[model samples]
Target: MVEPFRVVDLADWTRGESEPGGAEEKRWFTAPDASSQSGRWLFKPRRIKELTLSRQRRARGDAPDLLVRGEDWAEKISYELARLVSVPAVETELATVVRRGTEEAVLGSMSRDMRPERWGWTPGAALLAEHDDDFDSELSRGHSLSAVLTVLAPMNGPVGTEFHSWPAFDVFAGYLVFDALVANTDRHAHNWGVLQNPTTGVVCLSPSFDHGSALASGNGDVFRADRVRSGAVQQWCSRGVTKRFDGGVAVGLVDIAMQALSLASADARRYRRDRIVGLNLDLCDDVINAAPNLSDHTRTFVQIAVATNRRRLIDALH
Candidate 1:
């Protein structure tokens, strides 16, 4: 049996920095861990502001609804699932944040910074913009897979001992595969990028991050239950797409992932498919079942969605 993730209380931890550009609030702080490199972690609370609202709800004598948006557990579970398939991804942990004077604490996930010391993190939009003078990083109009691949083909995989010989495009294909499995529809141009060493002027792909938008995290419990009861999870997963790619047209997650894989080397393609083919459903169930603060409906819906998409990806890849 998989154990529940321990929740780190950050009420006393001093906020060191703030992260911008996302709809939700984010902060950077030094993690309590000793082994972490850089010691910097990003704290992103769940999309909903439940702490203050819950106090008001309680004052009104109503039930306080916690786990608003479910992104915290979604992020942690996605991290574990990524490990199951050997996808190099940023590590995330369940955490809580407290306002300075308030006793109420907001629940969130803390993502370990993937950037190595002295390396600069660059987003895909910036890379595309640099690659083509006409490309606009702010707009999604020109963020196509071909353009992304053309830029990645000449680069190396993420900077790590394990990724020494891997090509950037190869690892990127795995990222798409992971995205398809999770029904992630938010891989916009700003979502992915590379890390560059200032001294050597060397660049490499960065580990996948920012998965709080996956696994239907933004939807409420009622929506998840309705979809599961009506047996529409698979259909819903089929419709999940990130329009930020391929000229902003809505493309199915699985379709886009398969398209990316088709452009990769044969060995890399085979590796991704084999990982899915050999995946154990029970292990996935353990991960979901072990997740904290999830409703029964959410557990059932995510399990079915993953299994459904797994079948879809396997069929397409085979």
Candidate 2:
């Protein structure tokens, strides 16, 4: 049996916050790192504690900017993505549930004074406080196509000193593959990247982090609809092959992912064929079950999409 999830209490963070963990009290915070808000870590606390936790939630959204308030739900989502779908997403933990004796000032205290129109999340961070200055945003950071390619390349461990490029293209191919199986559509430019360790000559892709928005289509309001669509989805839903997502040509990671999905239909071969079947079977269950947020049309589209793209990928691979 699945263990009952515990609601995180705000008082766990500090004193003064009074709300219980029932209504608004059941919230997790994404503390803004000096880098990017997207880079923020998930902190599950109720009342008041660190000021860092307070600034994490914006006053305007009623909803969190990106971080989901309920840590329990978010953790499960991340786990399913990683374990079932094989996506290299974030490692989430149950930080702590502080049952503080204080009143509910944690909410009021952290409320921002910004205008509703002015409120927004910071997508990119110039630097991670613990890391070196070079990682920080400069005009140099967003300019080069090679620079974008470097994110997939292996770099130094943390400080990002060494330049050991990873089998970036392959890893990216893996991610695109896994994400497609799960019907995940949150692979925006901001969510994907590597946290380089300059010390070691290792450029590991940041574990495929942040997929809370993977199945959420309400995002059509905040972001571009196709921003997260798979190339296959784009092909079926939006007219034809899109260079924006598939890199235009029938190749690379997107192609590989689509083919993996198509393998579900084959009745021959032994090992590789079975692996594809398992992946497809798992993908169908996970996406259909966990995706309560998606519409019937959208979900069905994903189903057909995987098969269609699978065939596309197979043809390309052959």
Candidate 3:
């Protein structure tokens, strides 16, 4: 049996107000550990599969007490997967949030802030809006591949790190490949962006973040069990689509990933293709097996989905 992941309690950390954007509830907090190098972390609680009612409750100032899905585990797992595949991604940890002066703890995941000193994070939506005056960030109609590539063409890879030698679009292609492997359907215009320094005016692609929507996180155990038992897991994986990239374009996850690869340089195409083709299933199994509180059915479902998607992506690339 794999060992469980460590969960940090945020009761003692200095809590701040909630951060803006995204559908889930999130809050900013400063890590209290003096030994820790990271300064700020964003905590996102495991969201309920059904978010309409949760939104209503939040509007009414009530905390949701309904069934929370496995997004927290999905996030941590996605982080490990991205790291394994050499994708630039944010670091995430499983944690519990205990309100100040309260004993009850809320289960969630915390992502360390990746912004460098004197740099600000900007989402793709804002950049796209500026790139094209007619572009609407909230809608999927104008979030085209051509527009996104045009915005990233002139930028460099992530700053602060000398290891990244690729340009922004090349790295962005890797992000799409990672999304295809994990079936992350939430890579909307707002999900990705660039980091810019105000003083020197340097900009680069930001590491991939917000993967809670991946690996079938929103589905219930019954649905996963049924698909696994019925031997229809591949069917479900094939149906996975990223609606955020589709206005009426109607592209499958693998198709979109391949499209990005085609637009990328030969070096980037070879790099991402080699990574996908060389991905080890056993190591991926270790990631799935180690996720905290993941049911047997869910684990099996994720394994099959990833393996299926990997095959599909490889076939598409070939």
Give the clashing pairs for model 3: none
What C-alpha root-mean-square deviation, in Å, does candidate 2 show against the real structure? Answer: 13.6
- What's the ranking of the predictions by TM-score, best on top? 3, 1, 2
Candidate 2 per-residue lDDT, tens place, 1-318, comes to 234333223332323324242223443343333322222234433222222334445444344334222223333444454555334455453344333474423211121111122223222232221232443332223422233344434332111212123343344445555544433454444545555334543334455544333333223322323433543454542222212232223233444354433432232222222334455544554534453333444545445544554454344435
Ranking by lDDT: 3, 1, 2
Q: How many clashes (backbone N, Cα, C below 3 Å) per candidate?
A: 0, 34, 0
Off by over 4 Å in 1: 33-38, 49-67
Candidate 3 residue spans exceeding 4 A from truth:
35-37, 49-66, 100-103, 246-248
TM-score of each: 0.91, 0.42, 0.91
1-318: candidate 3 lDDT, tens digit per residue: 767777877877888779878876799888766636358889998866543456667899875454557788889999999988889888899989865467567788889887977689989988888888878766776788888899988898887554257778888988899999999988889899989888988788999999998988877677788999999999999998887874645578888898898888999899888999999999999989888787899999999999999999899888
Q: RMSD for each model, in Å, please? A: 3.8, 13.6, 4.3
Q: Which 10 successive residues of model 3 have the least lDDT summed?
A: 47-56
Cα lDDT of model 1 by residue, 94-186, tens digit: 888885666568889998888888899889998898778878655576688888898888788888836647989888889899999997888
